[model samples]
Target: MASKLISGGLFAIAFLGCLVNAQLDTNQTAQNIHDPQPQTPATQSQNTQSKSHPDTQNRRSSCVVEQQNKIQCGAPGTSATVCNALNCCFDGTMCYYGKYVTLHCTKDAQMIVIVSKDATIPNLDLESVGLLSKTGNCSPVATTSAFAIYQFPVTECGTVMSEEDGVLTYENRMFSQYEVELGPRGAITRDSFFDLSIQCRYTGSTAEALLLEMNILPSPYPAVGFGILNVELRLANGQCHLKGCAEEDVAYSSYYRDSEYPITKELQDNVYVEVRMLGRTDPNLVLTLGHCWATSKSNPLSRPQWDLLINGCPYREDRYQTKLLNVGSKLMFPSHYRRFAFQMFTFVSTGAADPSKGNQVTQTADTVNPTYEKVYIHCNVAVCQPSTQYNCEPRCFRKRRDIGESKTFTSRQEDRTVSSQEIQFVALSQSV
Candidate 1:
């Protein structure tokens, strides 16, 4: 009985131990399958919810992926609206910061976040206070146009000089001349003479006759002589010597015989020719401060076209009105001078009444000689109105005498949609 009882105790102990091992295994399996345990977010696998999932490798690489809840990381192309939305923040460029977002903790135990379209913010070294205190320009939009050297100063002898040549003396006063010592007997006229000497030593042929032409009639001429109206260099002998003169005898010493001598030889030497003319006092001799616009040849005048007023004049009768294009002047004067020069700057508009509006506007820039009066300009007109809109025709031509020689300059630009009602014009002259 004692042996049987010990054997039974040993078997009972083995059975109990087996039952405890089986219970422990059952509890572990249950815990793995159905235990309601809390999971740390860091250890949770968002893609695959499994106990053995590799959570460490599943984190998003970029903020875009995280925001989009996608695993792929890269810049989105145009096809991707979300990626394009992010791109809209940039100025059609790829910035370094566009790739990812970084988070950092500070020394004060506080977290600081910085955002930028680029990896680096430029000009950040500029002081914030300095930037805040800066001011900016408050003007109309700026533009640039083609720079030009329209005309230069030339001697009465037709010698060209940079603007630096002629000394800008009493840019005022009525009667002034280039104080040069020269002899006389060249062409000297009173009704159209000037008070300046063009060192004309180029005319190998002496002026045979001093002809006088008058554009304006002066009343009650003094017995000595009628004042000068205008003058020009009639002939020249050389290419190098000065050729034109536009001043009066009082402007220089009395003319010597050499000045009036005729050119005999046809040699290569350049000759100088002096032209003396008398000029009248022009009360309207003030420098124009700004330039005027070209004329609109298409527009006609409100008044009737006059009949052939002067005999032998062409039957042509059309006066196109013009308006001002630009509105500023380049000269300043303390007072108006008695003499000046003129040039035409034509304009084209839809409602011009005078076809000559382009040549009508003038400027008082001392172009050539001070004794020279307002240079007469010729304005020719074409069709005032074309059947098609935006059609352009020859509107105006600015004709002036370069010294005593005549020349014309045509405007290259066409007026676009210029309204007749808005055309403004100002003549380029001290006197109208």
Candidate 2:
């Protein structure tokens, strides 16, 4: 009886043990189906590639900011992205469109003379005859102090007047160029001038009338002032009068009052006038002259004096002779004096090359080699700042009447009159 009881107890214990082991096997199988262990080499590689490939795709996406994206432009709050191919540079204020063409400048004066000097009716001299008369070149080579100032009148203010249908094509006549010519002159100022004479074709046809627009890059200096822009034009009689001299209007002159940027005289036709640009001084003491623009004044010369005659020459020769002309002119013109035309905006080149070479810009074009060009500084004695003396009438701009050296004439209208021709510049006469 005792043996039988022992055998039954042992069988019951064995049965219970078998049931527990089966349950353990079932849980292990379930875990295997739901969750796998560590991944294999191939699986890990595939997972990594899956994670990285989309980032590569996202990086190349045009709409999204990518690593090597082409267009990086967009307004602060807006999504207007401009590509690099387009000349849309932010002025820090706004995205403006600009043309991307390389300018090849050479420091050789002979080359500049060839460039700044307008091509005379090379073959047919019809000006010696009557009826058809055209403008002449305004490049005058003069040595002043350590700098050799080359005043090349880029365009005639008269062309601005005759720009009918807005088709003034002076680009071919004067492409924007500045090169420094090294000679005895130690350091030349960047102020320059452009002369406007009659453009006559010997063909003698009225259809030969040509008009064009001229453009200059921003000034090199941080600031520029339109101090003295002397326009010498010839009337039908060939007598050159400083036609656009600032004619003062007491009411208009007072509209904008600034000690640094004062209008010496009102804008007028047929008389050279002293115009002031909106003046602002930077922390570095650099002054800038904003471009003159349109205003509703009684005078026709209300346009910011365009077709600029001279680049720099302080009206007050005593006060600002040492200062250099900042390259770019300001864009905002006073409403009162917007009709005036400008030729060049004087600038300083912050580069390793010569200061005389205005802005030693590199050429990106394949056809032309990289070169440098000389820049100049312009000064005027007439009305920059009124003379302290009481009785001395403002002297007209008079150039040294040297016969061989080219002189800057004031007018296209006074072609035949000798009295209209007052040599405006006197080189080596005054020590600046």
Candidate 3:
């Protein structure tokens, strides 16, 4: 009985152990279905690296070629795929040789020629073509499998300098050009040879310097009517008596210096005014002086003004003291120049009662305390192209037209208004 009981106890323990083992297996299978195993540290790091550098890892390196290295690599009109198959570079326009040879100018005006270490250009002699460096040698400054760079200064590399028509030209050589052939030793052809002509041209800096020296200001008026006509109104200088006021002589003088404004003049002093075209030298064009007047203020439209010229002629009130000078007839100036002289005077007040002496006023008193007033002279000038039917000369006493008449007496394209610098008139002084 005891032996049978011990055997039953052993069977029960064995059955319980099998049931525990089956429960553990079922839990393990359920967990596997719900959750996946986490990745290892090594695997996660590898995945991140692949995502960051996917393009870099997949793309092949491209060949970098300079413009000077654009020697023909294949026949004309070769496709990009064919060019790649030949191990050449394509710049979307042409197939050119890369990593073979190149010639270009440096920023410092130095010329550089580079050749690859694997390139072979038999019978090519740079020194023979006078392309030696300043050190009188053809040694490479740097050498590697990809590049053998040779540098030569533009001034010392057998360069020629010449000037023609004010243009400076610098060239490597005229007849002996830089040439090289790259191919097998005995199979070089015309297409395999590279020829380059290095040259540089420079217009001299004197033109810009001259312009700076002139310091000419642009005209305030626009180019209209007769096309860019420039008119100048100036007071005649002392040199006026010499040659009817030549531009160079009157340009700088004490009487009408450009640097001096508000020129001082005494009563009854002859004020010579010159009207001329600045750049137009056409002899057929005549300058005509029209309505000229003087105002107390700088504004031409100011009140209390005195008329010196009317209808291209001297005003009837001041005709005795105001007269047009024969500038063009003197042969000292071009036909586009006109001049007139008038005695400097002030206007009489309306109530001063000068009906007998005509409304003009002149200082006859030799008073010690002289009154001075600022005056500005304005003139209407026109350039006329003289022909059979057109006359630029002014004819007095023809007819008096009514004010605001639209009919023009002369045939002219247009009339321009020009004014002179300020003039200070001394009323009671006799000195000019």
Candidate 4:
């Protein structure tokens, strides 16, 4: 009876063990159905691509920000993404448009001649006995120092004109550009006039009917102030840091302001500027940026002013010079930009910043440090070829003087009577 009881207990233990093993197999199968296997890199990428929009597809391959996916622009106006419908850049009140092309600039005693000096116009002696006139296009060239007046955002270009258009526009002409070429928070300044003069000439028909006409006046007269820009380089806790000239950009350019990344070890000593021109080589005409001041009690037009640091020291030649330079300083140019109009590159190498001295920048002499290899500066000048689209038409715009009812006359108007017949005239009536 004892041996039969032991065999039955052993059978019960074996049956219970089989039931537990079967339950374990069922749990294992359920876990296998819910748990996922690790994915291969290719498989993970495929899944990620499936989630992205078609416009952003293959984004991993390119670094350029794809703009077409967002705002679509067509034509020149004040409301789209950019200002100046032609996509031309604005230099204070002036407009610069069209792709860059080469120009040759030259200065002289009579006039600043810029063009293909090699280019010539035909005299065209038609053998007809009469006053002759020849027309040939001339390029733009001159040295000037201007200021960066407006800081427009990529979003508020066209509509923000009244807020950003600090300079005046021409009554007869309007701009056609829209985008600012200064990059995200970039600014532009130019001085298109080094020396200026008003000219008058006679054009019309009939000996005594001719009249005089003057050239068109330049808009927003070549800035009467040197635009000030402060660039600083400093080392904080053994790390190299750089800064732009404008502290105000931070408030407007939050996108770039947050991108103030530290420089790598290799490029810590190098710096760059959008475009630069050494003010002068001889004695180095030193003038600070941000010039343009007004103190009118009735119509006050106050502007930023910078010190005219001549020869690394404050220029005492003009005591009033220290005060805000109300007028843009004359630009001292280099041999490369001596003649013809030529736009600068997108980025150019400039002097590096100092790492010491608390890295502080101010206008006072003690704070002024010009030891860098290149300074962030500009010329009070602009240039363009005839084929280019920029508004570089010589300030020589004029219309023929009007000649009224009396068509027959014997001598030039407002001049000594020239019955000598040495002065010939064509009988043509013009409306200016």
Could you say which candidate leads in TM-score? Answer: 3
Ranking 2 against 3 by TM-score, winner: 3
lDDT of 3 by residue, 1-432 (tens): 000000000110000000000011112211111111111111100001011112321221224545653444446676787655433467898765454333333333444444442221221232322232334433455443344445555576566667899865555521112211111111101101112234444453211000000010100111112336678777765644564566434432434554543344433556777777877656677788778887666778876667778767787754344677766354534687777777655432333223355322222212111122356678888777666645667766545653224224465676777887566542110000
Candidate 3: which pairs clash? none
TM-score for predicted model 1 compared with the true structure: 0.12
Which parts of model 2 have CA positions greater than 4 angstroms off?
A: 1-171, 175-189, 193-206, 215-345, 348-432
Off by over 4 Å in 1: 1-260, 274-277, 283-432
The residue-by-residue lDDT of candidate 1 on 124-145, one tens digit each, is: 1111101111123211111111
Q: Model 3: runs farther than 4 Å from truth?
A: 1-227, 239-255, 260-262, 328-333, 354-371, 398-409, 427-432
Ordered list by TM-score, greatest first:
3, 2, 4, 1
Compose the digit string of candidate 2's lDDT tens values, residues 1-432: 000000000100000000000011112111111110111111100001011111333332212212221111222322123212221233434332121110111111011111111111111111111111135433323321111112222243222223445332222232222232222212111323221122211121111211121111110111123323322221111122356543332112222222222111110112222233233222212111221121112232332111122222222222112222222333333211212222222222223233444433221111122111212222222222112332112122445343112222211121110011111110000000
Error of 3 at 22 (Å): 99
Reference-based lDDT, residue 51, model 1: 20
Model 2 steric clash total? 119
lDDT score, candidate 2, position 78: 20
Clashes of each: 73, 119, 0, 32
TM-score per prediction, in order, is: 0.12, 0.16, 0.38, 0.12
lDDT string, candidate 4, 267-321, tens digits: 0111111112233343222222111111111121211112222211222332223
